[model samples]
Target chain A: MKLLELQAACAAYGQSQVLWSIDMEVEQGAAVALIGRNGVGKTTLLNAIAGVQKLTGGHLKFGGEDLTATPAHGRARAGIGFVPQGRHVFPHLTVMENLTVGLAALAGRKAVKESGIASHIFDLFPKLTQIKNRKAGLLSGGEQQQLAIGRALAGQPRLLLLDEPTEGIQPNVVQQIEAALRRIRTELGVTILIVEQYLDFAWSFAEAYHVMQRGRIIRSGSTAMESASEISHLVNI
Target chain B: MHESAFLIGQVFNGISVASLFVMAALGLALSFGLMRVINMAHGEMLMLGGYLAYLTLLVVPGPLGILVAMPVAFLGAAFLGGILELTVIHRLSTRPLDTLLATWGVSLILQQAARNLFGAIGVQVVAPTWLDHTISFSTGILSGLTLPDTRLFILLVAALILGGVALLINKTRLGLYVRAVNQDRPTAAALGVNARLVDLTVFALGTGVAGLAGVILALLGPVTPTVGQSYIVPAFLVVILGGLGSLVGTTIASLMVGLFTALIEIYVDVSVAQVLLLVFVILFIQIRPQGVIAVRSRALEG
Candidate 1:
């Protein structure tokens, strides 16, 4: 079952067009990677699909439902979770408060009560429990990333978009994050779309890969050994 | 009376004045601090609230009229504020200067409309019997300490409004949405929060609270069409000096400004005191531009 499909999509930030008639697809329960060097439209494409950026042309569908015109909030309500780059956590709010912010989407006022969803997040990142009362800003980089992902999952999303989750994270925590994401994909059956710059990370985790360059996916293939080297060679290291 | 007694009396006077400023500044902070709009028409909303109180008197025409006026003025001003937010402010949310100029124009237009409707002459607002006396102390070292009944009323109203606002923002379910909007608008919306609706509600709540302030002000003296003009600057100062997006900061700043102005006016001319206070605020801003409390959020940092 196709979960997301983008056909000939075009997008721009003011005068600079960042995505040019890009075509992409993600099947249900599939772990897909969008890999590219810096300055490519990898993040921009994800933003368009997330409904944060409006596409200039073409169509986007999620769960066989048209989502080209849906606004970001509506898309969120429809169960597309996004953990944007830079771990944009609410710094002033407490850890518990930050988790509750994700529950805001389920229902206004009524869903605001403390619920069991938080315990699941605690299970995923148990460190959040000890410092639940502390402000989220004071958390370490890895903990903040976990909180960001945990916060997104609190919305009970059917699909997740993670952009550079391991950008500045330490190696041990990076392994832990990958393990958590794998659990989210296989155990929870949530569709995963990750944007990454590291060849080893993307190739190992994602079942298939899309290689982007200068606002276009120049080549794509299964995560085979020959294709992985070929994709890596296509870019200047 | 001893010098200490005189000082205590002036301190009390300053606190009462600060109470009034807090009532006015709460709305100013809500509009400027949260929405990021320099709503120059805020004074006009205050004036409109005064007019609503006057209209309430005409309809009820007794002690009962004062009772009817408070909620009517608050709701009326809130409704008007919501309309203005929808029609003008929302369109210019990103353009602070343009929003400021447009609201200034609105202030002028509203003042003109009020003058045309109620005439240029000031309209008298009658205070009830409960508000007609002063609580005075004339014994021991505290001889000649006098607190006006009206000032006491202002204090009560301020306490009630501040308490109500604190509860609404801190404890209620709507407060969650408000805080989310304040903290990270993009993330909030992406998490399925209706950010626009939250903006409209916060704007209306601030304007409505300002209307409550006007009701308290109306009983003090003549309710003129330009009554709001006198307080808007002080209210802005309170918000700025207190800091952006901190209610506690606004409260502390209000008391500071009120005390500073009152104490200075005792030793110097009122106009001289004003100039000195401005200089002090300028120096303070130069030292710490974020005011008493700097906000820590993704929006502020980025």
Candidate 2:
């Protein structure tokens, strides 16, 4: 069954339509890659799905519930975690504080206590635990990315939406992120929907791939079957 | 010997005045520090709180009135803050400059309304009998120094409120969410922090604290329709000089401003002292554009 589905989703910013009837789906525990070149509405699509941006038309269903009209906070409450591009971590807050911010959003104090989400997030990113007291602004790019992902995981999201997780990141740190994503998928059973301009890094973790161009999906295939040349040709890398 | 005694008396008077300024400025610091909203009408909010305290005394007689007025003024200002957030502030959330203008307009309207209802003349606020006395300490060379019980009460209240606000921001869950939103609003929202709601609550909390300051102001002296205007510049200076959104920075700045202003008033003419303070603050800003404590770097990133 589809854990998340976007049926002919149309979105816009102000007057210009940025996404044109975009359709996509991700099954439970599946790692789906959204591969697209710059300005192909990848970020807009992610924003729309996360309810940060309004949809011009069509519907969004998460865990079989229609989420088209839901506000961004409501979407988050309904378990849609988003890691926006540029790893926007709270600079004023320490790493632990950033993680606790997400934990505070649990349905109630009881839910937070039951989840032990902070500990689990720290366990996933051990580096975060070491520098948990350090302010997020003081961290390096790689550390910020880990804190960003850890913060999202603290919400215990059913479906995680990551936009350009590897963009501008060092290659070594990219490997660490891949390892973290693998752990999230294998250990926590968190489903991920990632938008990527970097095909090589994305294909390593994603089980399926969707290629978008000019605000619409041009191709879709299993990651195991698609060749590197095919991805390059689709994205024109 | 007599000149020394008079000088000491002037010093005590300055300390009292400084304490009041600190109270007024702390709330402004909290609001500007977290939201980056200038809240030009912050002084008016403080005046409204003072008026509320005055009104509370008229309605409820005796010491109980003073006790009730404190929380009432706070909650009342908080309610006003929440309303402003929904009607005006929410609209201007993305427009910082517009918020300044809008709140300034609100301030004018509130001041005129107060003048119409309460009259332009200052209303005398009666302190409880226990606060009307003076406390004195005597030493060999300095002789005895005297302080008003009311001023001491204000100082203690200011200290308590500041401590409470610090605890609320640092230790509590709500504080955690506020810090998160302040640090990175969009990211906080993505993490399910409910940024909008948090903004509203923070604004309300800051306004409520301002109202409490108002109640304390009323206790300190006569509360006129234009009383808030007197506090506006000092509060802004405290907030800006302390840094944009650092509460601790604001508190320290407030104390410094309070003491500095007090000392200046004693040695220099009051008007000249005011000008000097402004000039000093202007120079200080040039030196540290980010204020005494800069906000975390990520907070400034788009």
TM-score of chain A of each: 0.92, 0.94
TM-score, candidate 2, is 0.92
lDDT over C-alpha atoms for residue A200 of model 2? 78
Q: Each prediction's Cα lDDT score?
A: 0.84, 0.82
Best by TM-score: 1
Residue-level lDDT tens digits of model 2 in B170-260: 9998888888777666667766777778878888878888888889888877899888888877878877878877877777777777777
lDDT of 1 by residue, A1-237 (tens): 988999999999989999998988998888899988888988888888878788999999988889899888878777788888888878877777777778755653332353646566777788788888877778888988898888888887778999999999899999898888888887777898999877787787888888888999998778863456677776546
DockQ of 2: 0.56
Regions of candidate 2 where Cα sits further than 4 Å from its true position:
A108-114, B1-15, B296-302
Which ten contiguous residues of candidate 1 chain B have the minimum total lDDT?
B293-302
lDDT of 1 by residue, B1-302 (tens): 66767888889888988998998888878766667887898887778878888889888887678878999989998998999899999999888899989999999998989999999886877887878898877887877777888888888888888899889887876776677778777777777777888889988988888888888788886778899999999999999998876788899999999999989988999999999999989999999898887765344333
Candidate 2 local lDDT, A10-45, one digit each (tens): 988788888999888899989999987889999989
TM-score of each: 0.94, 0.92
